[model samples]
Target: MTSTAREAELLPAEDAATYAEWFACLAEPTRVRLLQAVAVAGSKSVGELTEQLGISQSTCSHHVRKLAEVGFVALNKQGTTTRVSINPACCTGLPHAADAVMGVLAPRPCCPDNLACDVTVRPLEAGDWSAVRRIYAEGIATGNATFETEVPTRRALESKWLPGHRWVAELEGEIAGWAAASQVSNRTCYAGVAETSVYVGDAFRERGVGKALLHKQVTAADTDGLWTLQTSIFPENRASLALHHSAGFRTVGFRERIAKHRGIWRDTVLLERRRSVESPE
Candidate 1:
């Protein structure tokens, strides 16, 4: 490993104290169980937790207190009764803390270097829309892509996606996959942040099309001054998640019951990749 990797593997001294506190809070199995129960049930009264956990009211309350002290759970008091809920922020913060300590979120390459030479990734062109939309339809049919039951029109996508950031991967002169970034917000403060999307054609499934498209997409975003790129993917889409991870994305957290798809509620894993400051513009 390089010196940079060595430095990243060692959790910084300033962060060690706080990370230790968070870990120590869950050192007890009962405390860990208490946090999990509250997290799953949303918000529950102490009595509800006690009965579900099969512990005495005092024991439940004691563990809850410990979790609350570490900012894992938030307690709301109401007329002699207290309801405990998992902190929404901690859902993402805890995982980020773990990644930081383990060095999984350390600075990495701007994009994958070993890209398939035969697959050509280039900026979107007028002729690429048909193929791109077709690939997107394939992803939607899988029922794990997005909540939208129908593919958006090319005009709609053109308006939403950043012009220079849109790209398509071609194999043997045929579009195999496409990737693009959409601005997350119109506000000036968030101009540097974007939400990304990538879809690969059915025929191109294991040919590194997804990887090539992501490498081009992320590298373009980083060079264009975009500091943050994020995406929410279905938990069942393991291939997409693995592709993004290889491109430097880290799991920030999981959003449970984020939306409904085909009349059934679905959850999504939120992942993000922040541009490394050391990377050249």
Candidate 2:
């Protein structure tokens, strides 16, 4: 680990209690199930959660209240029924908190993700899978770009990526690059808080294709109610680091030897950009 990465390992005294409280709130298995249920199934009444989770109404209500107290979920009363939903902000905040505690990242100062092609940016459609994967394979060919030695299957990418946030760029008529976001967590409160990936084809490098694709990705995320975006990059990939920096991402610090690529341990710089303005939606 480098000096910055080593120095970052200690948890700050001031934040200790807050992180502890956040973790404690989900200590119960029932509460965990409730959060996953709300996240996957959307907002639900206490009665609905009770039936879905196979718990009694009173028990369901009690756990929901507990989660709400720590900002994990929110409850709204509609006449006789109380609807429980995941907190939009906490969707990103809690995971960021955990990463900070583990010395893998720094606390937010505040935030913001993007790309291009003839250069046109549009939502990626089913027909674009081959092009997207081709671009992905090209990116993987660059040793510093990603850890994957082989391109992931389209079905694999589809299952891992969030819908609506996937985008592709075209130059003239050829797909030149792609960008997509993946869920950072399966927990309900973290819904829509995503980690982004942008890959440009070898032919499109340095052609402003990335910038165009990124613009579409972040704009779509904002309109879709995402408030935070995170990405990991190898320090050696200076162009990518610069692009993200220009897009408003701040370095959280080096996640030293975080993982292995090609049998060699690789260090990655963790970066996150929280939206400067909260999503109005």
Task: List per-candidate RMSD values in Å.
Answer: 4.3, 13.9
Worst 10 residues of 2 by lDDT: 108-117
CA error at residue 18 for candidate 2, angstroms: 24
Clashes of each: 0, 18
Most accurate candidate by TM-score = 1
Residue lDDT tens for model 2, 165-193? 89998897899899999999999888858
lDDT of 1 by residue, 25-93 (tens): 989998888888888988999999999989999999998998999899999999999999999988887
lDDT of 2 at 257: 95
| Local distance difference test values of all predictions, in order | 0.89, 0.83
Model 2 has an lDDT value of 0.83
